[model samples]
Target: MAEALNAPTETANAHAESFLRDACATLDRLRAMRPAFQRPSAGKRIRTAFDLADECLGISVEKEALLLRQALADRQNLAAATSAALLRLAGLEMGYRRTRGYPAVAQSGDWLQNEQFVARNSDLKKWAESALYMSAAPANWTGRIAQALFGLAAGAAMAFAVAAAILANRWFPAESIPWAILIVISYILKDRIKEWLRGGFLRILPKMISDRMRDLIDPKTGRWVGRTREWVEFPAPSAVPAWASPLAAGEFNALRREIPPDDVARYQKDIRIQAARLRRAHSRMNSITEILRLSLDAWRERMDDPCERLRFVEEGRVCEEIANRVYPIGLALRFSEKRQGGRHLIRRGTLFVTRDRIARIVIEPTPEGGIAGGGAAR
Candidate 1:
């Protein structure tokens, strides 16, 4: 019975391996035929190859699920190994497609397979990456509640002020000067009360709420793998952290030789992952990758022209030169992983940007604070 259950998984594994070998050879053939990709037969051929690759993964994943229902002792371990193997095969196919210039050069090559290949690549990426699903939302519930409370307090204060004025109107009679004085005092106090509460609440709001919350889910096992909370603040130059300032100023002030400007923003992200839960949910998964993309559309809009002309005397002759203009943006990063006994890593980098897009990024050498983990600091 055990062998009977194992036979399907073994066959699927062998088929997947065989397909990987053939897929590599097919890709090589396709790359060599780049010049002829304009032909309809070439597109059809490319489409057929990827179709088979997708079918191979689909069948393998379904077969691997069977081992979970079996009473065998090593079934979970076997399933994990099989899943890892399939994921590796898919990843390799995707990587080779890029390095060999399959789709990247297709636009200029005018390959008929361009659209199909893009769609196929996106599908393969999701399958090979993992079963993790993520969603993020603004974490402003506390802010809303605080706003409601402030409104109520303001309304109550104004109500009391109006009530007192009404009572004083009867006591001193509206026609008298004393009644007029009491009304003036009540109006002034009402405005002051509203402003005072608003100022206090604004100061306390940051400590009370995060900007956003993100949750990670394992779709396969219906379990949560991790969570993250992020905060963003525009701190004054004087308020920038002591450690971050020196690094930014060291590189930023080199060009102008002046004090660092006051326009500084601080962003922080706290991530908590359940290592044990992730392992249980996805035995093949080793680590999670987080991508942070900062949009510079506003900065780009405010930039000067991408290039400027300069006139200089060269060899005693007047000559004009047009040079590309670029600006430097400094970034100081500090990361802490409590799991590694509170290990810390610091990295500094500068991004050179043209008016249109980022040109390049240059990073300084790592400092004495060793990296928390074995992977490269991204």
Candidate 2:
């Protein structure tokens, strides 16, 4: 009995340590390749190397989560051990970031169109561990099927209108003047019909069909397991949820006096999995994680300089300091699983952004919910 209980702890520790070692090794390899990536023609090579590294890092993180759960269930006192491992992992990320010189490399002409793949290594790994399921295709392909289906429906509506007009002309032989008038009316109505259908579909599709569908594949079995939908909207201050508005308000109140109400946005992604299908597809698989990354490049286009001059007096002497100016974007995430008595988890955080990139993120502890920002990273 003692040995059986000890087995889980031992196995979990082993897996966790293995992930740490693998991550360290991967970073070391990337450090060695940094010099090669500095060349002008190294664009393709850079993408290939980073893409592989990202995928491996994502997989390692997911496996670690699985092990972490097992260890916790076994009631092992491994908090310190796990924290140490995670701290080391973060250290590796910082070292890699400095070694790569992301700010310099990102400015190169060859890095165009590929900038999104870099600089978020740490954030990606953090989210990957919590992702509910891995996307079979790249993130860009998530909502493609739904888009094509809607477009097809609109096109079919136009085709049917054209067919009906021809049938009416043939069935009733009218005068030239009447026929011309009929054709003009048909043309106007055809466009209106298509646009009306498209507008209505756009409004209703969010409820009926997900933004993403049928693309999530099980990594182990290479079979379909689940699907997901995502939404992004810029809501008015009055429309913000009561629970979340206070969090956003507190963030702005500390930074600036007057808040710009128009800039606030909300992002939500929903994942639905057929647990029975997942169990049948892979017996060992019980959890899935969705890793979502948002790019702030567009937001940085019109940003002011990264630093500003601030003057003050200290000890009866005037002094001036150039402080790095950072903008705070309030963020709140809510997670709830579809089950009886399932608890809703809301984690609040603020993203501090500089003119060039994200400086840091500070997540507050949720006193109400038992968990922290333990949900899959977005």
Candidate 3:
């Protein structure tokens, strides 16, 4: 009996060691491929990450085998080893995806397979539980509260408008205008008016919110830093100028004739400034065009029914598509806070989604004394 127990114990230990060794080797291979895997295309990077995930699943199967052996041996060491291996694998997967510019929400679904593996192996259950708890934590309570308040205010405004419309028909207009007609007109006009107000508010809201935030003074120099808002509008693709389009070259040439030869440098500088603005505008337009194209593709795939698709187009859901695109790709907002060696900070209430999409905005300091946005994938 003693010899039989010792034999199984030795076998379990060997299996555990082998499983760990293979897991590490797989991770090493992934790291080795990272350098050559650098690609400009987001789709290609996502595919590569998926391939890495498949390899991870293979490793997990081997881990499961070791877990079974450990259970047979009745050793606590097996659970510890399994937890460490899973955590390490998860860390590597997250790091690899992030480095490749994959959004957290996009990669989040891939973890479901890992979760299933954990479910089969009791050792990893604690890690899964902890992850759930951490994810559920109310880290962005301020954002949540602000969103709730905005919803409530919008509801209240609509209610008041309806009530006022009914009262006007009753008290002032009397029998001239029917209460039903008045209410219907008010409802229709209210949406149009709200759209107009929202457009104007959005134009200035960012600056207003930034002003209310704590001034970001340079930690080293204590100098006041000014905030600059960079607005890049993405109109329809047709609005964008052609790649080789002339940038007021004819006008510039005409102006050159009026300027003295000594002032040619200043004239050229003005032309350069205008040309740069045109280029920036074209770039933003192209980006938005691509984003809309992708979003439309996603929408079409989601709306399979012919009637549903037609309804989407007829209802002018392009605005919703634009919102979805912006939620994921995010709008760029550069600030001068980083110029003076201070961290970039935005007031929590300022960032918001235009539509009902579950997106969280993340701002990271860039190397060029600006901030970059990382929004959750819708």
Candidate 4:
């Protein structure tokens, strides 16, 4: 009887050891995952992941056995990397969707254009707005900062140069002054002139960017989708800018005018409106006919592979770019940002594919551009 009892005790001990061994193996496998724990102190480092075991669920899991698993994960596996990348992307979208406001979250369709409005442009538009722009939103400054600096510097420099010449009495008899202290007067005039010209251009730049971006992305049809040839107000046509050639003077109208849907009364529906529009009427006249004006932009990108990515921002240049880009091949996405007050809002605009890939998108302005509750129109 004693011998039999001892045998059972030994067997029980062996079973316990086997259980412990399996647990250790499982723990080691989890450690190989290289899971990155989310915490306030670690900044925003993204890490790969796997379907955490049930033990890893719940907020406090980080301090639990689940935490133990994450702590042990290996950081360099394909599966783990993919998970981390996805999480990071998802986090970005959440942040953007929040800042872009309710527009991106709108229901499928409503008084405003559908949430997937880009779906309407063309195959190229599709590749652009949806894929390219989305992937490149954080690449650069919006060009607003540099433009602001240049304008301010140009204005200030003119004012100072005038003041310096008058004070030093260098060149051009200072005594010829009608009032002797005319330097101050000229400085004021110079300052005002510089401001007036530069300010107008700056303000118009955003509007231009918005309009051209919309057309390239939307390319619908409307009254305003026609292209205009560059105009030169020549005095007897002696010194016309090269851009003012007769060939450049053609309206070169786009085939379509894309406009946004009017959704102010859309609360009855559960949709958010975008700030833009497109015209669908000009699809056949010419590919450049798109209201979103994407085709033109693509053409321009191809034409000017300029440094720092800041050339040909004007609609005309963008249109030309689109006209030229796709004729060749390969896709190059561009990204930028604009600052307002103390905060910065990054925007990703692109010359991409539309549904059938006709070439561009053009949207119409709804007076208010479908902005709700005092929101600015696109």
TM-score of 1: 0.61
lDDT of 1 by residue, 1-378 (tens): 335346566654554445445655655564565556546767886655554444444334333333333333244323455456555655554555456445422244655666765575576666555435454434456667777868976996799698878888789977689898888888888888888877777777666656666666667665666777788989777786655655545664686547557477788888888789878867887667777889889899989999899999999999999987998887888887655356678887888999987888998877665366544321
Top candidate when judged by lDDT against the true structure: 1
Q: Clashes in candidate 1: how many?
A: 0
TM-score for each predicted model, relative to the true structure: 0.61, 0.53, 0.21, 0.21
**Could you give candidate 3's per-residue lDDT for residues 1-378 as a string of tens digits?**
123224454554555556567766876776676555555554685656655454445445444554454454464334455545645655665555456553331234678755654544443334333312211112244445445555655665587677768687766666465765677777786676566556655565543332122222322233333222222233443343332122236776588558752110000000001224333434442221101111334434543233212213546554322223222232332222223344442211212232334345654333342333443110
Model 2 stretches with alpha carbons more than 4 Å out: 1-135, 138-173, 176-179, 248-259, 274-289, 367-378
* Candidate 2: C-alpha lDDT: 0.64
- Candidate 3: TM-score? 0.21
> What lDDT does each candidate get?
0.65, 0.64, 0.43, 0.35
lDDT at position 296, candidate 2: 86
- Distance (Å) between predicted and true CA of 324, model 1? 2.5
Q: Judge candidate 3 against the unseen true structure and give its global Cα lDDT, from 0 to 1.
A: 0.43
User: Arrange candidates by lDDT, highest first: which order?
Assistant: 1, 2, 3, 4
lDDT of model 1 at position 79: 47
Range of the 10 consecutive residues with the lowest summed lDDT in candidate 3: 263-272
Q: Summarize candidate 2's per-residue lDDT along 1-378 as a digit string, tens digits.
A: 233235565665565566567766765675567567656687876665665454545434444544554555557634567646755665455444446454312223666523654545444555445335454544554356557866877787778778867866886666576777777777788778877877887887766654544457766567666666666667777787765755445654666546555477877776777679778866776565556788888888878999999999999999999988898888777777555555667778889999977889998888465354433433
Q: Per-residue alpha-carbon lDDT of model 4 for 2-97, expressed as tens digits?
A: 222233434433433343345446645654554444444444433212222312211112122222223223322123443343344334433434
- Cα error of candidate 2 at position 351, Å: 1.2
Q: Which candidate do you rate higher for lDDT, 1 or 2? A: 1
